[model samples]
Target: MGEKTLEEISKAMRDIDITMLSTYAANGAIASRPMSNNRDVDYEGDSYFFTWENAHMVGEIENNQNVSLSYQGHKHFLIAAEGKAQVIRDKHAFKEHWNADLDKWFENGIDTPGVVMIRVDATRLHYWDGMDEGEIVLS
Candidate 1:
């Protein structure tokens, strides 16, 4: 097995927009949600996401660190990555992902009380249906 070059992974992320993050409850049922990509950390060591600690998704993440994210678009390409999400308490990063949309939920602006960021370190990524099909590439 070989590693996917940073450029390849970056291309895949740029070619796709949304990622479906799948998590679970203590009961073992599955839940999936569509989230916007950071667009800034495609091939970086970690992918960053913003979520409220009080949100339902945070509870699900606490129950299970293992997560699966899938990305697909009109380009007939699909990518699924298995990863572990960890909450980041760093204030600078939280402010970096913050936008006016976050103001809707956080009264204190980017430094809201319960605001959190999840950094996912993907261990495996499977891509298909792009310029190459049946290639079954892994990263």
Candidate 2:
């Protein structure tokens, strides 16, 4: 097993629906929660997730933009991404990443009140497939 490229790692992540989003809490502790990408796994060193504006994670992100995302796929494939997160309240941006599956969470879709989107732009990506491991640093 040799080093894996971003495209190859992205392909492996296509089926991974959920990622553990980690943020820094106000108390200086690390907080983590499972956030579904809603199948928006196009890679490109960026990931998006929708949540309410009042959510704790939102505040955490506001306090510290540095965040991490962990993904696990079949066949012992695992990926970890370190990035900076931005909270987006723009409805147009929401619509861009919106999908039918998200309707279950946001009843009014992008029109839902207080809805915000978190965009994590990965600066570093590390992947491990069984005994093989590699890392990619995005510019």
lDDT of 1 by residue, 38-132 (tens): 56445654677777788777888877898888878556766678788877778887876666665666688767788788877877776665455
lDDT of 2 by residue, 16-131 (tens): 99999999999999999999998887779989999999999999999999999999999898999999999999999988899999999999999999899999999999888899
Query: How many pairs collide in each candidate, listed in order?
Result: 0, 0
* TM-score for each of the candidates: 0.77, 0.97
TM-score of 2: 0.97
Residue 103 of model 2 has an lDDT of: 94
Model 1 stretches with alpha carbons more than 4 Å out: 1-4, 96-108, 130-139
CA lDDT, candidate 2, residue 6:
84
lDDT of 1: 0.71
Please give the CA lDDT of all the candidate structures: 0.71, 0.93
- Pairs with backbone N, CA or C atoms under 3 Å apart (clashes), candidate 2: none
